[model samples]
Structures are given as C-alpha cells and as structure tokens.
Target: MHTVAVLAFDGISPFHLSVPTLVFGRIGAGRNNGDPGGPYEVEVCAEHPGTLRTPAGFDIQVRHGLEIFETADTIVIPSWISGTGISPELHAALHRAHARGARVAGLCLGAWAVAASGLADGRELTTHWSSADALARAYPAVRVRADTLWSDLGDVITSAGVAAALDCCLHLVRHDLGSRAATDLARALVTAPHRSGSQAQYIPVAVPDAADDDPIERAMLWARTHLGDAIDLDGWAAVALMSRRTFTRHFRERTGTSPQQWLLLQRADRARLLLETTADTVDRIATDTGFGTAVSLRHHFHRILGTSPAAHRALFRREDRVG
Candidate 1:
C-alpha cells in the first residue's frame, strides 16, 4: 500500500482533515481498478504527535508523527494556521518528502506551508479566496490563483477551501483510478462527478449599500430587479447617469468585478434560489434568470459552481427530502 501522510496541527479544521481521508479511504488497493500501485493508505500525523485541538472546540487523537512523511508516497497539509511560522522540523520533512518524489498537496490555508517548503515557488496554486492576498504577500515567489478551485500540477497540488479540498482529492482519485472509478466514487459521495481543476470559484456577491440618492446603488438595484431584460453596459451606465467607462471603473471598484461578471453572478444566484425553493424547470428558470435557455444556464452554472443545473437541484432537493 502507498501511504498518504496527512499533516495535522493544532487548531486544524476537522472538516478539512476528513476530506482526504474520506476520498482516499475508498481507493484501497487499486487492484479492482486495474492499477498496479497497490492500496492507498491515509495516515494522520502531526509535528507533535498525540491529541490536537481544533478551532471547533474538539480534540483529535493522532498516533503518527512527522516521521511518516519519509515513507509516504504523498504528503498532504490539510489547512494550516495562518500567520503562524512553520517549524523547521516540519519544513525539513516536507522538503525531504518532495525531494524523494513524494507528491505534496496543500488544502486551503495549508498552501502557505507548501509554499514555505519552497515546493511551490514560481508555481501557481490556490487557497481560500479570502486569504489569497495574505498567501501572495507571505510567499512572493508562489503565484496565488484566487480564481481556481484547485491547481493539480502532478507532484504539487493545492485547493481553494473546505469544499474544494474534496474536489482536489477526487482529482487524485481520477488520476490514479481513472474517470470511471472517479465517477462512481463521486456518485457514492453525492458530489459532482468531475469538477475541472480550472473551474472558477464562486465569487461572493457584494450587496450595494442602501442609499436613496446613490445612483450606482440605484442602478444596481434596477439591474437586479430587471434581470430578465438584456443588461447592456451603456444602458446600465446611463441608468447611473455616468458614462460607460466611468461606470465600468466604478462598478469594478465597488464590487471588485466587472459589470458583466457581476450581472452573471446575480443571475446564477437567482437561479440557485429558484432551483432550491421552487420546482421550476431548467428552461423556465433559465429564462426567468436571463440565461435565455437551459444550455446557457447550465454553462454558467458549471463555469461558477462546477456542476450542472440539474445536478445542483438534485443536491438541494435530496437534502430537503432527507430533512
């Protein structure tokens, strides 16, 4: 069996630690799957072995120490403490692991630790979108990709946040076990079968401040209410009583995204709400949300959420049924 050593630390998120375990645990001995790499073993190790406390106010028992990284075929840092200096012992272990051809993965904030190991220098990776700035600042050589859910560069891998970590591990399964097995695993886990590593992370919406006299706010409100209508940039700018260029700049400055991108996100959000609450057909929801057709809605849905509209509905609908 190929051991996959997952590095744990104090204040680790339980959810992050469990993601790889759940995904790789299913891939025991790729014999049935026709892989010659034998079984995949998941081991949770820490800098200081034993019980570790999580931010969720719970403690976990870990039996292995950093020494496991030596024999492990893959090493995963499942989220790290932001702003905390990585210990020399851990850094040396990671460097040795990478030097011996063991794949290293960082999920969410764990990317910082991977970057600190000098493994990600000049390589683009992602972490939680909120911490992208800090990751870039701390490791100037590591290119921080805030947009992607994960970046799988063979030996070195990184994922965005909690949920994206699952996707990243699934990618590993697909790489090792093949697509057919990955699809079955995803279906068993009730997740998207294959979300591309390049799929963009969902951008959090920025609500405009409610101000009666603010033209930009008013224009945004107007555009939101009239999502079914074609929202032209010039027309939207005209509603704000500003020129197109000025409106584009100000809109980006306000929301940190272009008007078109904001509008698309708004439409997708609306579609999600409708899908979750009502039994609207994909075509109807698409039309109502200004996507024009089911295909367009599915396109944007995959682009943002990395899943199809029907699949998304099934998830929420299944939850409601279970509830």
Candidate 2:
C-alpha cells in the first residue's frame, strides 16, 4: 500500500487539515457495494508529536512527527497558517523526502513550504489566487500559475485555495488508482468526479443560484452527457432554451470561459480517462471523445496536459501493474 504522510502544524486551519485526511483516509474504507478499497495508508504528522492548536481554537493531537516522512511514499503539506517561511528542520525534511523519491504536494499556501525546499525551482506551481502575486515575488524561480485550480508536476503538486484542495487530492487518487476508483470515491463524497486542473480558479461574475433553472448550467450538463457528439454553440443554446448570443454571454459569466473552451477542456478530460482505463486505439478514443481524429486529439491533449496520450497511458498501465 502507498503510505501518505500529511504534515500539520500549529495555527493550521482545521478544514485544510481535514482535506487530505478525509480524502485519503477514507480510501480503504468499506463501501456499500462491496467494491474493493483503495490501496493507501494515510497518517497525519507534525513537527512535534503532540497536540497542535488550530486556528479554529481546538487542539488536535498528532502521534507521528516529521520523522514519518522517512518511510512515507507521499508527503503532503496541506496548508501553512503563515505563507511566509518554513522552519529549517521542516525544510530539510522535505528536501530529504524529495531526494528519496517521495511525491510531495503543497496545498493552498503550503506551496511556500514546497518552494522553501527548493523543489519547485524552475517548475510550474500554483497557489490560492489571492496570494499568487505574493508567491511569485517571494520565489521568482518558481512559475506560479494563478489562473489554474492546481498544478501537478508528477513529483510536486500545488493547488489553489479552499475547495481546490479536493480537486488536487482527487487527482492524486486518479493518479495512484484509476479513473473508475476516483469516480467511485467522488460519488461517495457527492462531488464532481473530475474538474480539470486547467480550469480557471474563479469566475469573474457571481454564480447564479444553483437551484434556479439556469440555462447555462442546464446547457453545461447537457454538453457533458453529449461530449461524444459534435456539439455546436447553436445546439447548446437550443438545449438551454436561449439564443446563441445570450447563451455565450451567460456561459462565460458563470464559468469564466467561453463555451468552446469549456467544451474542449471537458473533451480533453474525457479522452484522458479513456486513455488511462481502456485499450482502445488513439484514433478510436479520439472519435469517442469528440476529438475527430488522432492528430487533433494529440494537439489539444498535449497542449492542455503537457504530455502525449500514449505516454500517459503507458505510464499509468505500468504503475497499475506494479501496484
């Protein structure tokens, strides 16, 4: 089983601390459907092996200390109360974990700690959008992607604020297990199964009430279910009972992206899942995911994910077999 160590500290947000634990800790828990459990062992560790006071004013006792990183397959810095700096001991420990081939992740402001370890130098990273500028100025060596929900570079991962932590952790599940397992976990959590890391951090306009019969949301839902079909703006507008121009404006307002861009991201994400889980040929997968042809799929897939479909499938297959 993969051993995951989540680092905690005093003054940490309780919600932030719970993100990793809630997601990874429930990996192997029994499901009602008799589905096999996940293959992860998760633990919460801290600098001191004792109670750490949270910003919520409660003390959470941690039995393991930073030394847990010595045997951890993955090390996660959930979030740091102060995004300013990292203690020397913690910094050295992080470096050591990375040197030992442990996958390290920094969620939200914890990117500062990952940067402090020097692991993010010359690498693309992201943090809460509000702090993106500060992080960039503090660590010029790291490429800060303020717009993305999260940035995953295999060994090192960082996410934007709050709920983006769920996206990042779910991504880790998908990486370690498979798309189906991730989907199952998401269903259990009552969350969207997949939200691309490339998605915008926040929408510029206020979100309409979800309970309302919002045409944009209805159109999006329809589009998701019809990704295999050749969907156009006019077709989506019809489904939403709106004119093309009106639909376009509402789509951008609600999602912070144009209809075409959002469709492309969804298609790319679907293609990735097929690539990882099925033995279908690239051309066939492309057609199934609305990419039309292998060349078109390759272009957009690489542009969005920074890797080729074949390479991604091969890597996941190899890891799945090994696991």
Candidate 3:
C-alpha cells in the first residue's frame, strides 16, 4: 500500500483537510477496479502532535508528528499560514522525502509551503488566484499560472483554491490508479471523477444592485438564453435603457469581467455542455453557441480553456458512448 501523509498545519481550512481524506484516506473494499486495493494508509502529521486550530475557529486533534513522513509515499501540504515561518526540521523532512522520491502535493495556500521547500524551482505552479500577486512576488523563480485550476508536474502537483483541491486529488488518483477507477471513486464522492485539470475556475457572477433588480436581471437572463444571437454591447445597453458606456461599466462591476468576455465564456461553457451531454458535431455546437465555425470554437476553447474542444468533450462525454 502507498502511504499518504498530510501535513496538518495551523490555520488550515477544514475543507482543504477533508478533501484528501475523502479522496485517498477513505478507501472502499471494492477492487480499485484494476489498481492495488491495498489502499492508501493516510496519516495526518503535524509539526506538533496535538490539537490544531483552523481558520474557521474550529479545532482538530492530530496524534502523529512529522516522524510519520518517514514512511510517506506521497506528502500533501494542505492550506498553510502565509506569514508563519516554516520550521527547519519540517523543511528538512520535506526535503528528505522529496530527495527519496516521494510525490509532493500542495493544495491552495499550501503552494507557499512547497515553494518555500525549494522543490518547485523551475516548475509551473498555481495557488488561490487571490494570492497570485503575493506568491509571484515571493517566488519569482517559480512560474505562477493564475489561469489554471491545477498544475501536475509528475511528482509535484499544485492546485488553485478550496474547490480545486478536489480536482488535483482526482488527478492524483487517476494518475496513480486508472481513469475507470478514478471515475468510480468520483461517483462514490459525487464529483466529476476525471474533469480536465485545465478547466477555468468558475468565478461568481456579480451584478450591481440596480442590475440585480427586476428588469436588468430579466435582460441578462434573455441575453444568456440568446447567446447565439447578435446581442452586442449596444443591444444589451438598449435592453437596459442605458448608454453603452454606462452599461459596460455597470456590467464590468457586476460580472468582474467585460461583457464580451463574459458572453464568450458563457457561450463556450454552453458549447462544452452540449458537446459533453449531446451528440452534436463540433461544427453544430459552434453554430449553436455563436462561434460560427468549428475552427472558431476550437480556438476559443483552447484559448480560454487551455484544451481543445474535442479533448474537453472526451473528458466529460456520456459514459454509454466510446470516444
């Protein structure tokens, strides 16, 4: 059995901690379909063996210390306290584990700790987008990609944020086991077992108070339903009875992105859903989503999603059909 160790540090997010435990810690008795059913032995090792406080004001008791790392086949660093300095001993242990060929995982804020360990040098990485600026400033040598959900560089995997940690863990399971096993596990966990790691993080849509009210909300809903139509900025502004400039400003404030970008994203998302759930050809999906051509759809999917439309479809395609 592969031994998995999670570094339970102070101020860790409870959800971040639970992600790995739920994914790898709780191994069912069923065959991992083809992979070893020996299952992963999960141990939560902390700097000190005792109860630790979370950022949510909750407490969790950890019985093992850093010594548990000696047997770890993979070491996971969940969310970490940014300003808190890492101890020399813990650093040495992580360094030693990496030196001996143990896979290292840094989820969310935990990327800072992995970066601090000097293991991620010359490698691509990601963290919570909110901390991208700080992480870039702190570790200039590491290539910080704010666009990706996670970066899996074979041995070291870094995930973006709270929910994205699940994506990273699923990637690990898929890589360590197989796609079928990962899918079964994901079914058990009620998540997309094999979602592409490159999918964009779904930033919440924020609309201004006036826009959040009745008429503008109705207009926005209309626009969403009619993405394939010629709904330009001026057209939307007309729907809202505002000047194009005012509408653009208000829309940007509400959506945290330009109107055109948001529209494109929604259309691409729509196309993706259709490709996954329906048997539509790429060209048909393109026309349906206002992209006009399969080339345009592939271009946008690759540009925004970091993967081709066909690849995206293959990942989420219905189970009954063969890719």
Q: Each prediction's TM-score against the native? A: 0.62, 0.87, 0.62
Model 3 lDDT per residue over 1-323, tens place:
78899989766788889888778875523354434454577888898889889888779999999998887999999888764447899899998888888989999888988888878888878888888788878987888877768888767889988778988998787555545556667888888654455555554554446645644556568887897777778888888788899888766555456778877877876776676667889989999898889999999978865679787666655432632
Q: For candidate 1, lDDT tens digit of each residue in 215-237?
A: 77788899989998888899999
Clashes of 1: 1
Quick one: best TM-score, which candidate?
2
Provide the clash count, candidate 3.
1
Cα displacement (Å) at residue 52, model 1: 0.8
Count of clashing residue pairs in every prediction: 1, 0, 1
Q: Cα lDDT for residue 138, model 3? A: 90
**Which predicted model would earn the best lDDT?**
2
RMSD of 1: 10.3
Model 2 alpha-carbon miss at residue 122, Å: 3.2
Candidates 2 and 3: which is better by TM-score? 2
RMSD of every prediction: 10.3, 3.0, 6.7
Candidate 2 CA-lDDT value: 0.86
Please state the error at residue 184 of candidate 1 in Å.
Answer: 1.1
Write candidate 2's Cα lDDT for 9-108 as tens digits. 8778899988988888878553445345557788899998788888786798999998899999999899975457888999888888888999999999
| Clash pairs, model 3 backbone | 206-254
Model 2: which ten-residue window has the lowest total lDDT? 28-37
| Superposition error at 291 for model 1 (Å) | 27
Q: Cα miss at 276, model 3 (Å)?
A: 21
